[model samples]
Target chain A: MATITRVGDPADPRVDDYRDLTTADRRPDRPGGRGLVIAEGVVVVRRLIESPYPVRSLLGVPRRLDELTDDLAALPVPAFSTSAETMAEVVGFHLNRGVLAVADRAAPPDVTALLRDARLVAVLEGVGDHENLGALFRNAAALGVDAVLLGPRCSDPLYRRSVRVSMGHVLRVPFAELPGPWPASMALLRAAGLRVAALTPAAGALPLASAGLAGERVALLLGAEGPGLTDEALDAADVRVRIPMAAGVDSLNVATAAAVAFYGLGCA
Target chain B: MATITRVGDPADPRVDDYRDLTTADRRPDRPGGRGLVIAEGVVVVRRLIESPYPVRSLLGVPRRLDELTDDLAALPVPAFSTSAETMAEVVGFHLNRGVLAVADRAAPPDVTALLRDARLVAVLEGVGDHENLGALFRNAAALGVDAVLLGPRCSDPLYRRSVRVSMGHVLRVPFAELPGPWPASMALLRAAGLRVAALTPAAGALPLASAGLAGERVALLLGAEGPGLTDEALDAADVRVRIPMAAGVDSLNVATAAAVAFYGLGCA
Candidate 1:
């Protein structure tokens, strides 16, 4: 059984990982910065417990801790119980979610290994917005895209805002940064037998439905919302496809577009 | 030609319509509440000018007003030019978009009239979240969805947040409230020779790709993110279809799900 300890003082050394979350979250080089993945709220905390990451501990209001008793029973990690006010003092802001869990990052699965037996995957380029990145993973997971390979300039999917917006789905989807040089590195997928289909709004591209991607071992390539894929990236793809859109309308938000593409090419 | 006037005072009665946007947007019953449609930023401001809604006036810093000079040249409306600092004081916040336009709410197009000759339409129920509702319109417009019929429990799409999130497409695509009763009112769509296809995650629903909705005159019914479609609504539909999703994953965001459906059933 996990030990439960009451922490009355915000300065308590044992609860140091829970301090000044707003600033600490930005200091990724610090203990809780990029070094640790932080999950807030009960739903996300549960996901952290089940994710590949190693759970450090949990801090929550007494009632919130009580709600996770069953999930904590098998783990021997420390669970800090505190009043809402004390919790807020340590967290820097009053978090209405009432609970939090922190964990260490785990080794990302190998690219070739993850691609093995995978029929559908998303290859992302320049998708630097955190929320958009997070929502993409959530959609990918829901639509059954096997894995995500980050090309160049993608943001950290584990950022707090991303984790929250994704409803903890960033923890569920498997993602790894693409190894080697940018566009040249894409040969890795082709070598692994996945066809690279770039998604664009360009008029010349085939409509997603007619592109004949749904039944294949497809790796959909996506770019940032505004400045879409670079010329080299588009040239590298086996085929280019687009969602047929009405004239004069701007492109859909990046993540929304990705979900549509995922569903279109997703396995039935 | 539009008349341009220089305004120096924040409390000037001429700009009262633009006051305290944060709370002012909520009191839809108040003078500027539901009575007016407010468009912020140059892009949306331009859309408001092009929309059927009658533009009453505009407030902007000198640079932004100058930018709108060509679009405003033909309209005989007041354009108040002020400094950014004074504009902020008047609006009760820093209006970073640098321009604002307010227009009177126009009469919603008749339901039967909007449905005429439109091959694809979306019939929404309980999609009350403004951002989701707005994004849905953006997707609908991009995918050539002809119109939207708001059923029960839906929030006002003209709400400021919705307008911003839709990137002003809510102003472009036509939407009208579904009149008469709840799901029973859907018969009008049937009368218009359109099939009512409800989207659900139920096991028995046909996969969207295999449902053969493409190229059909279909009104895709959507519910809120959680609770999904009501039983009465589902039972009333001509056919039930679902986007195939992976096991253990939660349902897709209501708006994202709609985009996929729109693209799938959209004209080639």
Candidate 2:
């Protein structure tokens, strides 16, 4: 059973893991950073509890803690109950979510392993926008993608905003940085016997549904919003596929496109 | 040919239409409101110039103005060029896009007239969130949705953020409020010979793709992100469809779900 403790002071040493959260969460994955996985609100906190990461503790007001009592009863972690003001002062921001949980960052999964056993894996390059990154994970989780493979220049998906925006799916979805060359890193998916399809809006590109991806093991390569996949990345792909859009239209938001593609691939 | 005027002062009365954009755009369609449609950036401004709405004026920096010279050359409207700093001061925030355009709200196309010819349309209810409402329009446009019909409690699509998020497609795609009794108002679409398909995550929903929506003229009913379609609205729909998300997952974001359904309807 988890230990429940009452903490009145905002500056208590025991709750340091929850201190100055806004600043600390900025570069949790950077050098000299703790890289803690933080989950906010009851739903996300519940997700963090169930994830593979090791949870250190939790801080929240009584009402939130009371709501989570059943979940806490099953966890072995400590739960600190405090006032909202104290929680706000401790975290340097009024966390409207009422509760926060922090867990240690787990190691990246094996790329070949994830690809070999996966039906649909999203391969991303230069998708640096945190919100889009988070939304993509949420879609990936909802659409039943087996894994997400990170390409070059992608943001750390564990960033707090991404974590929150993803509704904590960033922690649930297995992701690993594609640890090799730029465009050539794509060969890893091919070697694992998965077709690599780059999503583009070019006129000559084959329509997504007809790209022969339905029921195939596919690693769909996605890029940042405006400057989509680089030329080299496009050429490296086994084929280029487009979501047929109306004429004279700008592209759909990256995450939205990924959701449609995921639905098309996953459900087909 | 459009008249080109150079304004050096931030407080020029000629550019008053562009002042206090953050607040001015809060209620662009309400009582005593300016009822002006504003588009930001060159891309959107260009779209505004091309939309059915009557262009009131254009305020932009020299570079953006220069980029639009070809389009401007064909118009009789005034294009006011100003410094970025001056434009920023007038706009109540940093004008990073360096351009803005304002136009009168065009009279919406007759609801019956729009439905008469539309192969596909989106009917929204309680979609008060501006960004979602805007993203829905963008999705509708990308999927070649014929028009949008607002049922009730929907936000103004011409709001500045909506216009921006819709990538100015809000100006292109026609949307009209569905008047008359709440669910009964749906008969207008039925009168237009379009079948109304409501989307929900309820267990009884038919998976979108297998529902035979493709190759059919249909109207899709959508709702706010959290609450989804009202019971009355659901009852009014001819059929209920779902995206078939994984078990125990919350429903997809309203706009994302709409996109999947729209594509599933084979609008492309």
Candidate 3:
């Protein structure tokens, strides 16, 4: 069972992991910075406790902590109970969610093992916006995509804003950075018998429905909203497909487009 | 041609339409509120210029205005040029997009006329969040949804945030309130030779792909993310369809789900 500790002083060093969280979670590569995974709100905290990440501790008001009593019962970490005002002082902002949990990122799953029996996967390139990245994870999870592979220039899916925007699905979905150089690294997917299909709005690409990806092992390549997939990545894919779009309209948002393509791929 | 006038002071009354925009655009129903349609950034501003709404005027820095020279050449409204600092002072924020345009809300298209020749439409219920509403509009425009019918508890599509988030699609795609009482109003869509398909996450609903809606004229009924379509609305629909979702996951965001359904309807 977890231990509940009452915290009153905002300056107490015992709760340093929960202090100045805004800046503390910004750049994990910075000196004295640990890339800790943060989960806010009761629902997200429950997901964090259920995730593979190692739980450090939790900070929340009494009411929120009581709500998580079942989750905390199995958690071996300390749960800090504090007033909303003191909690806000430690976190550097007024958190409306009333509860927070921090965890250390676990080692990523082996790429070969993750792809062993996967049927549908998403390979993202240059999707740097945290919110978009997070939302993509949420869609992938709901749509039943097996895993996500982060290509070059993709933002950290574990970023705080991404975690929140993904509704904490970033914690649940399995993701890993694609190893080795650029497009060549994608060959690993082919070795595991998956066709790499790059999704683009280019005029010449095959339309999504007619691409015949349904029930096939596919790794859909997606890019950022504006620039889209690079020519190198496009050239590397086994096939290229596009969602038929209305004339004169800008392409759909990246995450939304991914959901459409994921559906067309028949992952669900 | 638009008349270019240089303004040095933030308090210039000529730009009153652009003053304290954050609060100014809040409630169109409030006293002294005009319910003006606002467009931000170069792309959205150009969309506003091309829309049916009557342009009041434009306020922008020289560089952003220069980019819109071709657009302004065809517009009759005055263009107010100001420094970035002055623009920020008037708008109550750092105007990073560098341009703003205000337009009066045009009368919504007649419901019968909007449904005429339309193959796909979205009917929204309780979608009060401006961003979700706006993103749905953008998705609707891209996925070739021809019109939107506002049912009830929906926010103003012309609200500034909705306009911005829709990428100005709200101005191009036709929409109107569904007339008559509650779910009974949906009879209009059936009268127009369209199927009323309610989108739900209920397990009993037919899965989207197997629903056989492709190439069919469909009026997809959507609702807010959390409390989805009311039972009354669901009971009234001719058929109920759902995007297949993974077990133990919440439903997709309303707009994303709409996009997937719109794609399934074969509108694009």
TM-scores, one per candidate:
0.96, 0.96, 0.98
Clashes counted in candidate 2 amount to 0
* Best candidate (score: lDDT): 3
Model 1, first chain, TM-score of 0.95
User: Residue A236 in model 1: shift from native, Å?
Assistant: 2.4
Expressed as tens digits, the lDDT of each residue in B1-268 for candidate 2 is 7787999988899998888877676664554456678999999999999999999889888999999999898888898988988998888899789889998887888998898889999999999999998899999999989999999899999999999999999988999998798999999999999989999999999988877777778999998999999999999999999998877567888989989888878733
Go through the candidates in order and give each one's DockQ: 0.78, 0.73, 0.78
Give the C-alpha miss distance for residue B14 in model 2, angstroms.
Answer: 1.7
Question: What's the CA RMSD for each of the models?
Answer: 1.9, 1.7, 1.4
User: What tier of docking accuracy does candidate 2 attain?
Assistant: medium
| Predicted structure 3: clash tally | 0
Q: Where is model 1 chain A poorest over a 10-residue stretch in terms of lDDT? A: A26-35
Q: What is the descending TM-score order?
A: 3, 2, 1
lDDT of 3 by residue, B1-268 (tens): 9999999999999999999887788667876567898999999999999999999999999999999999999899999999999999999899899999998888889999889899999999999999999999999999999999999999988889999999999998899999999899999999999999999999999988778777778899999999999999999999999999988788999999999998888732
Q: Weakest 10 consecutive residues, lDDT, candidate 2 chain B? A: B26-35
Q: Which scores higher on lDDT, 2 or 3?
A: 3
Error of 3 at B73 (Å): 1.4
Number of clashing pairs per prediction, in order: 3, 0, 0
